[model samples]
Target: MAKLTKTFIDKVEPPAEGYAIHWDDKLPGYGLRVTANGVRSFVAQGRVSGKAIITTIGRYGLFTEEAARKKAQKILQDMREGIDPRAVNKADAAMKVTLQDVLEAYVGRPGKLKASTAAEYRRQVEKTFAKWAPLPIASITRDMVKERHAALVKGGLEGKKAAPASANAAFVTLRILIRFAMDEYRQADGTPLIRDNPVDALKHHWAKLGTRTERYIDRRKIGEVWNKLHAMRGEVQGYEALASVDLTIFGLLTGARRDEMATLTWDRVHMDDHDPAECWWHITDRKRGEDLQMPLSSQAVALLRSRPRLKLADGTESPFVFPSWGKSGRIQDARAPMQAIGEIAGRHLSLHDLRRTFTNIAMRECLIEKFRTDLLTGHKPASDDVTSRSYLNLTRLNEWLTGEVQKIGDWIEQQAAIAASKNVVPLQRSA
Candidate 1:
């Protein structure tokens, strides 16, 4: 063993396999550890509570030989006093951990989040909060939240000003993170590590953003919307584009959410059953975290049957009803195609607009019961009264839902036919 210096440590080489340690004679417990992969780290070894303990100070380049020695001496002193350096180091690390660290822990917690939700949370964290990620979570203050929220509304983190809704989403994501950190992380004395959540200020901030209008396709334009979607399918080629058309139509007919339809799989679609009454689509993983069995209309079933199966590189078919060549192996977004159709219909629409359109037609035109529409849309019951939930048997209600959904499908088809007929020009004989 010899005195460890930058020059001395730099001279040390990793073994062919495993790792080798070089101790400093001047600092008994201070040393340099080199791994087979050529990683060099400063480490300290000492005895605490009559047991040997080794703690890594940091990497060689990140920590100088002198700094490593100083840190190692303090650790050794703590060990001599019956304090484990590793425990102290962990406590200190907990205090200095960044927002990114908390986010990673929150997202990675087993069974705490659905796959879709986890993906959204990750996108929000990496995209919206990238600047604040490295900063310690505890250092974030109410004033900082207010300024950042305003900045997001005025000039987004990505250099363009986001709308009130987009800014509000960022604030909500931050609020969730702070709340999770407050509950999950604690001090050694059993008190919360974070005394107050800065995001609470959002309660007041949200009022100034203004209430957003619910954007939906007008009922009068439903026929035009249907006609335009059909025209779009003819204009676009390939299974992917065609699949988007079918998915959009299905969304309008069934009132299913965009992700719910996009991520649908073959296993969940019950096209043929011994009992025709049993034919339905089984959405096992819905946003509300419940399984919903939606009865299929003839039009819906026809659309499903017409869809081409996508084959993978392994000579097997993909399970996704709307499969894509994308990394996710399923249709992630139909917004672009929906926007094109929206243009022809003389309205800018989102996938959710299709859902809203379905509900509108169901209530206003078809005169379907509100309770039935709520069930078809997978919405929670308005009244939590026990009697309201207990009296109706789900099996029997499926029959009613099946009929109601079929009515919606029939109405959409009728509208499409009316729009198609209107396009026909009558020829007049020349006088």
Candidate 2:
């Protein structure tokens, strides 16, 4: 046995093979284990409930002789009380796992997270929880989550603008990550390291995210908004701008989500110039995790046809219909163009608003059946509707869907023409 002072521990030679332990003459169970690989670790050895236990406290340099001695004293005390030091060490480790470690593990599981979803998780971590990422997961508390949520709502973090909606979303992502941590990490006693999600402190207090149901382009201004998008495409300088404008138009015409439209490839498109009714496109990796095949209006087919198949520097045409020079190989947003269109529409608008507009046109203006309209807009049937859920296969009704989309498309053109002619009137109920 040695006194386990820094000088003595550093001077001790490793064994020729296997390993050796130099026990502290001053502390009963405290010792340094030196392996043949030149690794030295602080350890505590004792008996608990008539069984022997040897637990590595930590590595040598990470804990000085004094610190390791104090830790070893605690471990020895626990062992004398019939508590397993190994379990205590494991619980300590579990509690020290950082937020970043949990997120990386959560997103890294095979086939567990979609690419778009994983990207959003990364964004939330970087933008909303960057300060918390390096902290131990167990250190995030109920009060911390509440205070952070309030701070996020008021635009106080690094002078970012008020983002109530984003704040709500951020906390939701936190709740999910915390739940995953609870399931994954455990104390040696078989209890979750995270017993309660700190986000639950906001149980009844989540900020109300504004509903987008009423945010679609007004029927009266559809033409003006459409024409403005077209004019901007011509005036904007870059190919990226052109792709963005077209993406916005395509989204409005087909009622597709922004990401769905942005990621569309040429191979998913089925078109026939000779037969307008045969034009359709398919989405494989939709948010609902279901494949969607939609009948395209003639306007949509024309827009797709106009997008040039420009050869890239790699001598291959980009797969994305809305291609971009960015690393994504596709345009992620039409923010500038959407803002310009919103100026014409008389309100702030989003890509999702275009989907709502298409729905309103199909169901409200054209009097399409709710079931068929839902099909056109990629909505699952109402949960209580057994017939639609079990019996109906809406995709096979392509002819009906084709006619319905054309009706909405034709109405839009008429409205645009009326506006272009400077003869815009209140939309008539009879028309």
Candidate 3:
């Protein structure tokens, strides 16, 4: 490239076809180019601070000489300030999106969410997403992510409001959302927009301290929680409706993750699809990662049918077994109904506790055995035999797992009756 002094830019002219300068041209950041294509592009003379830093300005007539000089001078100024021009360009390139925008796109994406599960994301978004929303995409550096993550660990959402586990949930949400952007978007040069996500830098922190979402609540007090849920009353249903009944019962019976049960569609549930000797729920991908096919008991089916034809805004039957609170034919906040039940029970118990309760109850029931029980709970198998159990040509395994879940359901229902005996008087049926 020719010397890019003020005189050079003022008096220098382009060649008939291709322009070149003797000082230096081909090396990046060394020279400017005004190709026959009429594009006036900048080519920096050298790397910035030993890091390659080559960036383009604009087209020839499209970007005036005066405008190009200003941008060039700014780049030089940044270099003088010990701010690598390459880094500044890289940083500027990454700021095309914001943290808030990425998260909203993720949670609001149309698929696989039970109304209740989606609502939980909404709650998380409302609380944490807002705090980081304004941050530029590039500004969401490893340091920023680490600072927030450390705060979550040291105290959780401010000194001690959310648990470490809850804080981790927030982190996971951020990681997945940011990752989505990196995998999806690209730069003007067609390079990947984000080559690396800062979230990956924090994986060690997360791995050493297991995810915040999976803390196992103890079992001894779960019975108390069960009793409370059985005794609680909903507003309109008072202490009596089946909708309220199914909410508490299903959680305890299947040991399926809470949202997994909430998003159940009758079509996915085929209780009558099998012979009496072989009933099934035919559960689908309730958890995001794997394909789960949970067989249902007659009791599971009964609990499911207990709230058939969910409330719809148009007053017609809604497709969802559990409609969205907003009447979008999706489930409303699943945690809300379960939480209400807990509040009524006077325990403030979480729905996840119901899963723990299911595990405990299953442990007590030898009818289902160990690995089979874990299968129904969606926990990974303890052995190869257990892993292969679901794949067996079950003239019996299908019926067997369904029977196991049903047996556990029966045990839970019986205990629920006992718990409610002292609380809610109207026991139309057991949990």
Per lDDT, the best of the predicted structures is: 2
For model 2, how does the per-residue alpha-carbon lDDT over 119-209 read when each residue is reduced to its tens digit? 7788788768999999999999998999999988878356565556568878999999999999988897879998989999998778765
- Local error of candidate 3 at 108, Å? 13
Greater TM-score among 1 and 3 belongs to 1
Residue 219's lDDT in candidate 3:
40
TM-score for each model: 0.68, 0.82, 0.60
Q: Whole-model Cα lDDT per candidate?
A: 0.79, 0.84, 0.58
Tens-digit lDDT track of model 3 for 1-431: 35555465545566678755323332234456655444446544444566655556555456665676677667666655556665556545556677766656666778756556666766666666566776666567788778777777676555763345556777787777778878766564456667788877777776243332333333433445555545542333521243444665667667766566556676666556447445555455445325556766666676565565755557766555655445334543344445555544444345576676677667765455676776777666545665365775422335557666767666655655665566657537867
Selected candidate, larger lDDT, 1 vs 2? 2
What does candidate 2 score on TM? 0.82
Q: Which candidate is the best by TM-score?
A: 2
RMSD of each: 7.5, 4.2, 8.7
Better TM-score candidate (1, 2): 2
> Which runs in model 2 stand beyond 4 Å of their true positions?
1-13, 22-26, 48-51, 61-67, 82-84, 87-96, 135-167, 182-212, 287-290, 382-400, 424-431
Residue 175, model 2, lDDT = 93
